[model samples]
Target: MQKKSALGIMVLAILFVSVNLRPAISSIGPLLDTIRADLSLSSSEVSLLTSVPVFCMGLFAPLAVVFNKKLGLKNSIAILVAAIGLFTLLRGILPTYPVLLISAFFIGLSIAIISPLLSAMIKRNFPTRTASLIGVYSFGMGLGATLAAGLTGVFYSVAGWPIALASWGLLAIAAILLWLRVKEPVAEVSELPLEGAASVSPWKNRRAWYMLLFFGFQSALFFSVITWLAPIAIEKGMSILVAGAVLTVMSTVQIACNLSIPLLLERWPSRHLWIMVSLGFGAAGVLLLMFADMIFIWPAAICIGITLGGLFPLALLMPLDENKTADDVNSWSSMIQSGGYIISALTPFTIGLFYDRFQNHMISLSLFLGFIAILTVFAFLLNKKPESAGE
Candidate 1:
């Protein structure tokens, strides 16, 4: 009974923390124009707000392992979550662009630290239920993103961007409080392999490269859409409220997809096939947005959301499926996420630059489609066998 209670607390803590992960960044998407206008930021500068945090996610993920080793997982996560809340609050209160950018970077760094640690926590505590818990984690993230995307405009209308952006910090505060109440189980120590018996690096493996590409492009797609979708809708003549609704719709669909994909993966024999199919939806969605009339934005958003929902969770699960030991999982996850996010961090800024250069979204949408294509090819090329350190 005591063990089950502890497990329950851990699960709740994970879910709450996951819920706080995306809102600080995702909220910016729906309110991009308002923020840009209020601060007199150029498109490129605003794009940096989105891109910097994601870049930090990649830049700072490797440090998570070191922090976990030094501070212990729970304490490290607590400090990071508190930092996230602090920065998020500051992001709203701060008037200067440089201050906002700095806050955004710290928020990203906090998320980066918390992200991998959650995976390691799940792997360590709920080994038997890692996939399911990951699905729940993804679902929480999607849900948070959906709420932020959907409601930021409403909050903006009511109280302006400062309150709208800062409101998300409250959720982080709640998560931190809940996290503080949970006692972490003492982690079992595993002996590091001797120097001669060191595991093969994931970087040397072709399969790991393919997995990284798959993860990277999917992340690019998701971030690009989140950052640009509402603006694209507004450019197509939709009202701010309507654009927010479209984003909300997409995120809502993502929540459903994130929750269900794990179940499908369990039953499906070919993960690659599912990945390809999901990528196809993403490509089709981009194409739809590229060519379709504004009236069809609803369907386009749904397609994109479905793609994000399915692909994001699957991308996360792939690393766990591919690696054997917890150490290998950590190493591969760090490598894949670090490299993938660095690549992904470019998407929004590049797409924004393309839009700025061409004064049209065609080139940007085309670039997004190209990323989908790359991800599809990589998905097809992924190895059928599970990854082993010996390999």
Candidate 2:
């Protein structure tokens, strides 16, 4: 009974952290024009601004293991939550582009630390429930994105974008307080020194590298659509309200998909089939949107959401599948997210740059989606056989 209660508390804490993951970054997609106009920024500049947190997610995640070792999970999470709150609050108060840029970097860093640690913590503590717990946790992330999409307009109307952006900071404070109440899990201490871990060389593992490539390309697709899909709708003659609704609809579909995926994975146990399904759904959605008219939009959105809902959690599960120790999971997470997010960071700008050059979405967007589909297949094939050290 005591263990169960502790597990419940930990799960709630995980959800709180997950909920804040996307709101700080995803909210900007809808408010891009307002932010750009207020700051007198250009399209290219706005795209860069949006990608900042993602860059941080990748670059800082690898450091989480070291931080966790030094500080312990409880203290590290508290510090990160507090830091996230502080920087997010500052994100709203920034008076200039440079300050905003720096704040964006810190926000990304804070999120980066939290991301891998949460997964490793779960793996260590709830070995049996890793998939189920992470499923709920990932759903919280989707919920955050959904709320960001739905409420950005309402918040912007009530208090302006700055206040709207600042509101997310409050979630961190709440999470920090609640997180303090939970008992931290006792995972075996890391034996690899910091320098040794850093020098371990990720290139030695061919399967891990392949997993990184696959995760990166899929992220490229997810981030690109997330950042631009609503704008694309508005550009194509939809109202902001309609665009918001479309995003809401997509997220609703995603939530359903997220809930269902864990059950499927538990039954199937073969990740290749699931990965292929994810890639296939995404490809179909993009193709449908590319060719079909307004009538096809919602269906395309649902397809995209379902594909992504499955893939995102699946990617996180991969590291755990490969690693026996918490340290190994953290290391793989950093490598995969770093490689993945490096590619993801380029996607929005790449799409924007291509769109700017061609002044059209037809070929550019198709090429981007198509590339992600192809990469997903390649990674799926590599992971088809059980290759984890733990396995």
Candidate 3:
């Protein structure tokens, strides 16, 4: 009974932390207009605000190992979560645009550290139940994004952008407090050597390279949509509130898909097939947005949301499938996520650049479609067989 209770607490802590991960980024889309108007920022500048944090996530991913070495994974994650809360709050309250940009960087860095640590923790503590736990937290992430995208406009309408943005920090604070009470499991300690470990560098492996590309392009699709979907909807003749609601519906469908995909994989375990299917849906959705009328926008959103919901967890799980030990998982995940996020971070900014130049969604949607094509190719190339150290 005591063990079960502890497990329950740990699960709750993980879910809460996951829930706090995406809102800082996702909430911006719905409020981008308000923020731009209030600050007198240009399209590229606004894109920078959205893309910089994502770039930082890649920049700071490897630092998770350093933090773990010094503070241990448990303490490092606690500190990171607390830092996320602090920076998120500051992001909204800062008096200057420059300070807000700095806050976004810190917030991204904090999330970067927490992201890999949570994956390694799940591997260490619930080795047999990785897929299920991943699904749970992925669901939390989707739910967090859904709420932020769906309701931030409403919140903005009520209390203004600052409070609407700052409010998400409270969720991070709650995660920190919940995490404080849960004891760190003994399994989290690294059994492998600390220095000069015999792990293969992921960069040298062709299969790893494919996985990295797969991860990167999928993230490119997800973040691009999260960053621009609301604006695109507004451009398509929807009101800001309705646009936000469309993003909300996408996220809501993502929550359902996030929960279902892992379980479906358990029965089928067809990684390539599932990934290709997701890409197909994403491509269809993008094409629909490009050519279809406003009446079809909700269906397009649903299709894209399902793509995000399934692809993210599957992409994450791929590292675990490839690596045997927790340390290897951490190393490979850091490499994959670092490179992938850095690549993915370019989507919004590049899309923004195209939009700024053309003053239309045509170039941006074309770029998105190009990414989907690249993602489909890489997903097909990713190895399905399990990999081990020194492979």
Top candidate, metric lDDT:
1
Query: Model 1, 282-330: lDDT tens per residue?
Result: 8888888999999888998988888988888788777678766666766
Clashes of each: 0, 0, 0
Regions of model 2 farther than 4 Å from truth: 1-4, 184-202, 319-334, 376-391
Error of 2 at 285 (Å): 1.5
lDDT of each: 0.82, 0.75, 0.82
Residue by residue across 118-194, what tens digits does model 3's lDDT show?
87788677879986787777777788889899988888888888888888888987898899888847344344222
TM-score of each: 0.92, 0.86, 0.91
Model 2 pairs whose backbones collide:
none
Clashing pairs in 3: none
Q: Candidate 3: lDDT of 14?
A: 94
Arranged by lDDT with the best first, the candidates are: 1, 3, 2
* Model 3 TM-score relative to the real fold: 0.91
C-alpha lDDT of residue 269 in model 2: 87
Which residue runs of candidate 1 sit more than 4 Å off their true CA positions? 188-198, 383-391
Candidate 3 — which residues are off by over 4 angstroms? 184-200, 322-329, 383-391
Which candidate ranks first by TM-score, i.e. highest? 1
